[model samples]
Target: MTDTTVLEQTQLPIGDWEFPRLEPRGYVEPRNRILKRTGYYGGPVKGAPSTSRQVEVLNQGILESPMQFEGLLSGVETLSKTPSVNDQFQAYALGLVDSPNVVEAGDVGVGKSTLMKCDYVLRALTLLRRRVVVVDKKQQSPTEPWGEYTNVAHTAGVDPIRLALGDRDGSRINMLDPALSQTRFIAGDTGALMVLQQAAALLNDGTPLDTWERKALRAALRDGAAQARARGRVVNIYDVLDHCGVISDELTRQMSPTALERMHEAGLTLRFILERLPEEMPGLFDGETSENVKLGEKLTVFDISQLPEDGPAVPLAMMLANAWTLGTIRRSEPGWKTTFCVDEGWFLVGGPMGKVIQSNAKLSRALGLSNVVNIHHISDIPADDPAVAFIKEAGTMHLFRQSKADDAVAAAQIAGLKPGAAEQLMTLPKGQHFKKVGLAAEVRIAHFRSELERQITDTSAGLTGAAL
Candidate 1:
């Protein structure tokens, strides 16, 4: 027989920060020094290093030792004169190391991405020297670390490189110089390479492709073998391009008033311009995916910034799905942990990328690959979004503010707070926010960011210049 036990109720403790303040200075040498001059988000440093071989990344980066990292956190509190936050941050990082994921939430201008970029991520990467995978649908700002990661890699004695947006040619091989052969761009329409090749061929051959022909050409885009098989393939855009040929730069410059009209009349939809993208150039929409993984030393960047103006959220979802699947399948041996840091998680979770991220979510934890996802709004996150499974499973989050009405509602619900409070939290005054600690703890705190970090991250001001 079991004895009935009485449960004791305890009052939640509230405290004034009345403990004696420890004397500042004299503990440790300055450990947490901010290295960057600008506060804005900039990618990796360019011209950092070059590689000679394909890197089989068996381990992640090493910019920080665990002890030093903890020390750095403590130093941050020192800089701000705040109470020791080491325990809180340590708990957060511990949760991340265990689960390997965290969500940053809050209002529009509350510095979600910036916090990720500056407060923690860059230093971690610097410590780890780990290769990074940045999956952001937003324009690749020149200021962010993604672009300069290659330079970081180079400086760290790792052959890191950034592929030009459309590095993959018709063959899907990341095309870059032997020196800059450390980066791999794996996003979008890489399969469309040969189709464009075929269209260019057709154009060279003097054949014209109507809309139906364009569709057929799309088939050719998927596979070079299929493209090759089309010997007498009904001349489409490729044939037309082969025949009329690309307008010479001089011709383009001397185009008469009627020339622009004639060019437009020639079925030059923006898509066609995209479809007939550069074969030799390095940026978005270069070609198809190769069955093989990083072949040479090229750091390839697949620039889909030119992707049809439709919201990239869905397509991005699809791309992330296929990309990780293919990359993982290729590298599924032991000791292979791929860390993927994805920006704008909310959009992909509900769209095409959901299945891709979901299928791998549980499996990756075992593989040592941690997916850190970022999102702009809570509403953009679907109720059953697969990423949520990982987000919950990973059990660490950095909730920021949300200013939008719909987003506020969703954020409020997820944070388990009064619905009305969500809106206020979303519109929280600068430097203040409600941070939800996984599913267990919640805190409303004043947030702060370096001034430089603020200017680059300020979306309201509009991007000052071309992003990488």
Candidate 2:
């Protein structure tokens, strides 16, 4: 038989099937198919205008004015409206930010850092009437975003105080200051002991003090506080060490010989750690706090920009700054909103002070405090580290452009993002991020900063030749 005749005999007979009726001979439609000729089974109609989503979102309502809360809005702060990524139709309206904690993660140049700094810091200082403390490590030169923002802060009556190492005339924070110690001294001896424990923890980099070390340090701090009280002087670290250097005979007799021996050894080790820290890290924390170190109606920048990035001083400074800020806030009148922001917070959260920052984060709301923490990558944080819990507990998260697949995955998991978010992270253009507030669906935000804000927060001023 001829080839053409054979093919025609084997193929199914031609039929007029077009458009909606077009289907293969054996094709079958499943009963559970989501898309139908009319519309999606559970969603909007097929080929509906882009305005549909906008109408749906707006129908839910725009943010209520902060005035609605009146008395309860005491520490509530208002931020610029969060705009939707694209204006194909209408933008989704975001409410004023009142969350106790905000965590942001992204790769470099993705704009997450600038967004939080300009938005949160500006709102906190101006609108919220809150004292702000920022541990800034990114201002490498005079034109950097933080540096320019400092100028803006200065003009706004919020003088920016830069505390850098070796700047003797600049701000200083004495971790061993007696007044600072007294803040930790709660109920007399109990409080005094706690202060000593903190000192031990600080010196040991947050590892728990050993039993013998604890006993010895507590005894010494207890005794030193008494002596300082008698002399009308503040008890400093040296005094505690001095007390340890000579364990009183009466106290020594009370302990078993082995316990006494343990105390003696622990005292020496503690002394070595404290004494060596000053020698190793000189101008940062070795003296009385600078007289200029005041948190008065201004933004206090713990300008550790001069310190080496990988050195131990950064984390230590963060710990001291956190302690100092907490104490200052507690001493202030109640109902004042205060925001504590840590930029490049890996130093604070991924270091020995992680536990300190974590505990402070938990007590933030009760204390009328707001903690804003930023890091480059979620995967950089160890899974079991205390910081993981801190990141997870945050009420708001801004997930910016992630450069690595693993980082995107970790960010998604930590933020409890939708499964598709992992893939979205890979393709997100710069300056756009996925923001999730509490259990709400993630919103795509195209952050809009004013010209003034741009001038104050442009990190690429040098490369772009942008003027302040």
Candidate 3:
């Protein structure tokens, strides 16, 4: 049997050609190693990407010393099918990026949706050398398909996998290893999965949080909780989950009667979460769900666009569980390299995600996970301090085009420049973005679109679908 894992890492047998020296990634080097861990936000620190920026050859460059070498250039012929081209697969074989995490920042319509394009990620897959896992939101429809591959690109080495939210437990996703089943599952209609997961854990561990942690979580779970308390007004479910994370109106319809009944029987109809994540939150595919969150050194994109406007409730649950399970990698299992990336990361931030990122960022490295998060804007995130800290620790950042005024302002403020430092922000063209690393010169990235856009419908699967 062709080992899909091995297949994912194989390189395109296309050349004796020299790869341009990776331009000095410079200061971001420390953070660059962030995504090397086996999974989730439990690693040293840093990160990777997609698009035209993912171009394989220099479309144009001054071959400094245009012919300092004469015979070095022959009538260039592609290295057709030799094991030599697989050199790039070493990292995967060596277990470099077992699970990868990431967070992207940009306003709506500016390609935040476009960021996870498969083409670039597939190119990156060649280097990381690991299986791919996709966690898109739970929706009524299937994910945008990405089927079909040019016989050429396939041989060139584009390996990947895709999974949808509606999947039953133990269902095999296209690119992910079937063995890579979720350890736990968290479920909720509201975006309070994090709170519930933590609440569940805190209860299990029998550890109560201090006042500050409670305050942070309350604020995170509900948008109007503080104001309600301040004004002596009533705070309800609508205020916390719905209004805050833009909770789903549809969730009301989808709420399972059996689960609700079970919850009531358990004497817990709802859960409230605050700061400290649980020791662990496990998942069950039979449908009794908990937040099934896991991290490893593989590129994991949790796309929430399909969810109701409320954002992702599951991540909170996963974060809570992770806070319990993987948090002890230091005492538990050392020498693991990992990176965690959260796409459209609003829900997790400030609520459960913010707490996890905050508690783990500085220390995760030794345990083998580096954390990277993507947000549409600074305001979308809940924590003032942690949000800024995450941006800084990310080492390398990409600023995609955004249409939001306030979010744009927040992005600039977090960047820590004068009032107008983000002036270029307004002028950014579609699919064009800005990039920065720890003290590295801020650069621009022109997202290279995957031809997959065309195959986003039926008949197209992995390399083709475009989720809108």
**Best-matching candidate per lDDT:** 2
Error of 3 at 456 (Å): 5.6
Q: Higher-lDDT candidate among 2 and 3?
A: 2
Candidate number of the best TM-score = 2
lDDT of 3: 0.39
lDDT of 2 by residue, 103-161 (tens): 88998878866766666676446544567787777764554533434654654565555
Residue range 356-445, candidate 1, lDDT tens digits? 566556555554445556666667665677755655555445556676777777766665664467656655655444544455444444
Off by over 4 Å in 2: 1-99, 142-149, 152-165, 176-196, 205-207, 226-231, 252-262, 295-298, 461-468
Stretches of candidate 3 above 4 Å error?
1-103, 118-121, 128-135, 138-316, 320-337, 380-385, 404-406, 416-421, 453-468
**Candidate 3 displacement at residue 284 in angstroms:** 4.5
Which digits, one per residue and each the tens of the lDDT, describe model 3 over residues 30-130?
32234445454364565445567767465765322211121111111112221111111222233432322234677655655444433223344444333
**lDDT against the true structure, each candidate:** 0.42, 0.63, 0.39
Q: Which scores greater on lDDT, model 1 or model 3?
A: 1
Q: For every model shown, what is its TM-score relative to the native structure?
A: 0.47, 0.71, 0.44
lDDT-based ranking? 2, 1, 3
How many clashing pairs per prediction, in order? 81, 1, 75
In Å, residue 32's CA in model 3 sits off its true spot by 56
